[model samples]
Each structure stands twice: as C-alpha cells, then as structure tokens.
Target: MRRALHAAPEILANFVAPYGVYEMLAAHWGDTDALIASAVPPLLWSFYELAKTRRVDAISVVVVSAILLTVGATFMGGSARLIQMRDAMVTGVVGVMFLATLGMKKPMIFYLARATVARGTADGAAEYELVWERPGVPQVFRVLTLVWGLGLVVQTSCMCWLAWIWPIGRFLLLSPFISFGIFGLLMFWSLGYIARRPAARAILAR
Candidate 1:
C-alpha cells in the first residue's frame, strides 16, 4: 500500500504529461462531452430540491448557458483581446450560473454541501429541499454562493494573469501551490468546525 501510494504522484504526472489540457480532462473523466452531462445533474438536482420548499421557479441553467458561452467566446476569438483574457471565459459562465440561481435566491454551493447536512442522500433529491428549509441553511447557502462565485472570478483572473506574464510551463508550477494553500486553509478550518459536530463530521470527514 505504501509503495502504491508513493507511485500515485508519478501516475498523475505521467497522465497529464503527454496530453493537452482538454485531452487530459477528457481522458481522466472518460470523455469531454461526458463532462457537460456530468455537470448538469448537480445543478438540476439543486433546483429540484429547492423548488419543493421554495416556490416553483424556472430552471437555473440549461443548454443555452453552455452554447451561448461558447458562441460569445467564438465571436471574440479573432479579437486577440479575448484570447489573452480567454481564461475569464469559464469565469463568466460560472458567474452566469450564480446569477441564474440568484433570481430564485438559491445559492448553488449548498447543493454541493447538502451532503454535509444530516441524511443528505445524493440520490434523494427531495431531501435537498428538506435540507434547504432547515434553520439558517439558506443564509449559509447565499454566503457560500457569493464565496464560490467570487472565488472563481479571482481564481480565473489569476490564471489569466499567470498565462500573460509567465511562460507556458510556469503556470503549472505556480498554480498547484496556490490552490493547495487555499484549500489547505479551508480544510483546516473545516476540520475544526466539523469535529465539533458528530453527524456533520461524518459527512465532512468522508
């Protein structure tokens, strides 16, 4: 087990080393189109869950969100300005997602965090609605929503900045440290918080 664990880093390094970024994500997740299909369910589940306790609202996101995004990027492709700041493209898409959910006063992050709530079975969509109506949940979700959206914006901006100033390979070197540091802090904070609650800690500790 120790030997296998030690080799895990090499396995990951080797996987990405030979492939382009798009290719790597595709292969890792089984295929590129699979990524989109995989992404939609969680958001949809969130809506379905929230809609029960809250009023019935429109869908938060759908095909147009993805297509129009690509279209917008395509229009600016030749502009060179878009190409350089093109990293912001995904950020814009995510911001739009938050906006779409904002109309319903639903924050997208809590959908992901629902598992942290007691008895949040991912398969049980109705339970998400139940969770949403719990005390202080919606407020926590909105803060989570803002944090998620703002964090993505800042992260994307940093990526663009790195790509602009650094050479191609350097961004890879720098990004991991920055990401690790941020996640490390969050993880440490969460560890303390979760440790205090046995039920919530079970979910988080997982």
Candidate 2:
C-alpha cells in the first residue's frame, strides 16, 4: 500500500496528464491556440518536477523534455489529427531508438532497466553493472528490447490508425488503455522469459 501510494504521482503523470489536458481543452476552449496554450503549462510543470527530483534518471528527463517539445510542435502547427498523430510519434521515436541501439554493446533496454531498477542506490547500481557483464545476460535484454521496440511500434501504428479513423474523444479515451495493456503484456512476457533463463535467473537472484 505504501509503495502504491509512493508511485501514484508518477503513475498519474504518465497515464493521466495528457489526457486530462486534452479533455479540459476540448471542454472549455474550442480555439486551437487556446488549446495549445493550456497544454503548455502542465507539461512545463512536469518538466520542472522532473528536473527538481533528485532520484529521477537521466532518461526520464530526456523523455519528458522530448514530450514537451513534441507537444509544442504538434499544437503550434498540427491539425487535430496531426496533434494526435504526433503524440503517437513520441512512442514511435522510442521504438526507433530501441532498434537503433540493438547493434551496440548494450541494447536500449539495458540502459532503461538499469535506470529503472538501479537508480540512486550504490548497491543496486553495482548489481546492475555486474548483471550486464554476465554471459548471455545482454542477449536476454537484447531479445526483450527487440520485443519492446516492436511492440511500441505496433502500438503507434494502431494509434495512428485510430486517430485517422476514429472520433477524437473516443481515441483519446481508448489510446492510453491500449498502450498500457500492450506494454503490460510485453512486460509480463519479458519478465517470465528472463526468469526462465539460467544466466538471467542467476543475476536476478543476487
């Protein structure tokens, strides 16, 4: 319960923030510029919070900043459909980044997982470093990263399709759930797959 409470703010920020802005903008203000202006403040607040938090990983800062920039551009010039489509681009960019890093010594997922699981604590950081060095460990993360990358791209494609064909209100209501659902499944599968791997199990047991 305590852990859940601790996570609530981030969870809300990630899942609810944009949707809330969109809803509010759609409700009171019909003008595009007004919608755009209203959207900026919440994102700025998010950026500020990300910068202020000592425990935040670098990736979080980068991701939030990317979101702010994308939102700004989308609102400044994009049509309603374009705004929706551009929003999906953020996830798409992450997918591209993941695939782009696959040829490197460390896959994108390695850094993401490290930032998530090993942030702030020295002991956790040491364990993550050792995990990446273990034989076959990188292979596991590489495969998982590939899955995640492809999954995100697939999600983006779906969002694009819906944005083009579906009502904006309906798309806004459903897209977040769809994104979370796909990611939850992928995360479950990746964790299960890793747990079954001998090398991954050994490292995780540490």
Candidate 3:
C-alpha cells in the first residue's frame, strides 16, 4: 500500500494527466497538436524521476526512452492516428528488448526487480545482488521476463490493431483502459507466480 501510494503520482502523470490534456486540447489545438501536448506530462515526469534518483536505472531508461519515442513520433508529422500508434510501437520495442535479454546472464526482469527491491539503497541493492546468486533465482527472473515480454507484445499488437481500425476519438477513449487492463493482469500474474516459487518468495520476504 505504501508502494502503491508512492507510485500514484507517476500513474497520474503518465496516464491520467496525459489523457486529460489530450481531451482538453484536442478540440482547440487539433489532434496532432493535442497528442504532442499530451506527451508533456509523461516526459516531464520521466525527467523528474531521473532527477530525483540522480542515478540511471533500467526502469528510468525505459520510461525516458518510451516518452522520447512518443515525442519523436508526434514530431514526425503524421496523422493523429499515426501519433496514437506510437505507444504501440514503443511498447513493442520494449517487449522485444525484454525478449532479447533472455540471452544475457541476467534477463531484463532481473534488473527491473533489483531496482524495485533496492529502492535506491546501497545495502538493499547489494542484498539483491547476493540473492541473484541463489539457486533457481536466475531461472525465476528469466521466466518472469519471458511472461512479461510475451504479454507486452500481445498487448502492443492489440493496441496497434485497434488504432488501425478505430476512429481516433474512439481509439483514444479505449486505449488507456486496454493498457491498464493488460498491465494489471500481467502484474497480478507475476505476483502469483512469485508466490508459488520458494526462491521468489524468499526475495519478496526480504
């Protein structure tokens, strides 16, 4: 609950505020402009997070990269629909990155989990590093990474298909809900998966 409270500001900035911005501006500024304007909140939030942390981490890189991609796509001057499709493209790319890391010594989820667990403390970070060496820990992260990668890819595909066929207003109305739904399911599944694994449970108990 404390973590959830701490994350509320980011959630509002990235998802809620952007949608509100687009809705408020779309009528006056036009879709392309509104889309570009809506990117501001998340971009600002990403930079703020980076500044607050004063250290680069996997999650920070992903958030900043995704925001930059969105901004770049908007500036490319395509139709509003194309701008809307930018989120799908960014998500797909990140999903691919997750899958690509499967070949590495530690998968993408390992870094993400480590960052979350450490919470900016050196001792916590060191503890997680030591935990990584435990038997089954590596495999757990790999499996979690695979699940998240596949889930994100599927979500991106769905978003792209919707953006392609639906009208801009309708797409905008539904996309956020779709994103939240998919992500919520993925997170729920991850918690359940971790709960079932003794190694993962040990990490969580720490």
Candidate 4:
C-alpha cells in the first residue's frame, strides 16, 4: 500500500497530467504545440526522479527516450492526425528495442522485472539479481520479452491503421482506451504465464 502511494505521483505525471495539459492547451496552442507541451510534466518528473535517486534504469531510459521521440515527431508539423500517429511510432520503437535486446546476455524483460521486484531498494535489487541466476529464469524472461515485443508491434500497427482511417478527434478520443486495453491484456497474459512457471513462481515467492 505504501509502495502504491509512492507510485501515484509518477502515474499521474505520466498518464493523467499529460492528457490534462493537452486538453487545457489544445484550443489555444493547436494540436501540434499542445502535444509537444503535454510532454513537459512527465519529462520534468522523470528528471526529478533521476536527480533524486541518482540512478538510471532501463525503464527511465525508455520513458525519457519515448517522450523525446514523441516531442520530436510533433516538430515535423503535419496534420493533427500526424501528431496523433506519433504515439504509435513511439510504441513501435520501444517494441523494436525490446526485440533488439534478444541479442544481449539478458533480455529487456529482465531489467523491467527486476525494477518491479526490487522497488528501488539496493538490497532488494541485489536479491532480484540473484534470482536471475536460478534455473530456467533466464529463458522465462526471454520468452516474455519476445511476447511483449511482438505484442507492442501488433498494437502499434493497429493504432496506425486506426489513425489513418478515423477522424483526428475520434482517434484521439479512442486511442487511450485502445492502448490501455491492449496493454492490460498483455499484462494479464504475462501474469498468468509467470504464475504457471515454477521458476517464475520462485521469484514471486521472494
């Protein structure tokens, strides 16, 4: 419960704050400028967290990178639809990054899962590192990485197609719901898969 409370600010900064900023500014600034400006809260929050913690992790890098990429896309200055489509590009890029990690000794899921399990404590992080050495744990992370990578890619494709066909206002209205739905499904599947794996269950028991 304490951890969840601690996480609330970040959740609001990343998700709610941005949308609220965009809505507030969009009428005056237009979609492109409003879109770029909406990135400010999360960007600032990310830097604040980084400064406070004096540490950088895979998730931090990804969040900051995605914000920069989306802001950059807005600078391209096309239709409002184009600005909306930038989100799909960001997700697709992260998905590609996830796939790219397959070439490394540890997949991206290892770091992501570690961050979740560790919850910012040095001792907890060290313990989760040891969990990585357990039998079959590495393979589980790899498979999860693959699944998540493919899922994001598919989600991006669908979002892009929808953006292309739908009006800008309609797309913007529905986009968050679609994204949340896909992400929620992926998370559900991942949890169930982890639950069925003995090695993953061992990690959870810690």
Q: Of the candidates shown, which would achieve the greatest lDDT relative to the real structure?
A: 3
State each model's CA lDDT, in order.
Answer: 0.48, 0.73, 0.82, 0.80
Q: Residue 87 in candidate 1 has what lDDT?
A: 29
Best by TM-score: 3
Residue-wise lDDT of candidate 2 within 123-152, one digit each (tens)? 775678778778888789889879988988
Q: In candidate 4, which residue ranges exceed 4 Å CA deviation?
A: 1-55
Q: In candidate 1, what are the lDDT values of residues 53-97, reduced to their tens digit?
A: 442212223333544454455344342333425623565467557
> Rank order by lDDT, top first?
3, 4, 2, 1
Give all TM-scores, in the order shown: 0.51, 0.79, 0.85, 0.79
lDDT of 3 at 61: 77
Model 1 TM-score relative to the real fold: 0.51
Put down candidate 3 lDDT per residue, 50-132, tens digits, no spaces.
88887667777787787788777768878877877876778888899999999999898888777777775667666888878
Which stretches of candidate 3 lie above 4 Å from their native place? 1-12
Residue 75 in candidate 3 has what lDDT? 80
Clashing pairs in 2: none
Q: Candidate 2 local accuracy as lDDT?
A: 0.73
Alpha-carbon shift of residue 189 in model 2 (angstroms): 1.1
Q: What is the C-alpha RMSD of each candidate to the true structure, in Å?
A: 9.8, 3.2, 2.7, 3.4
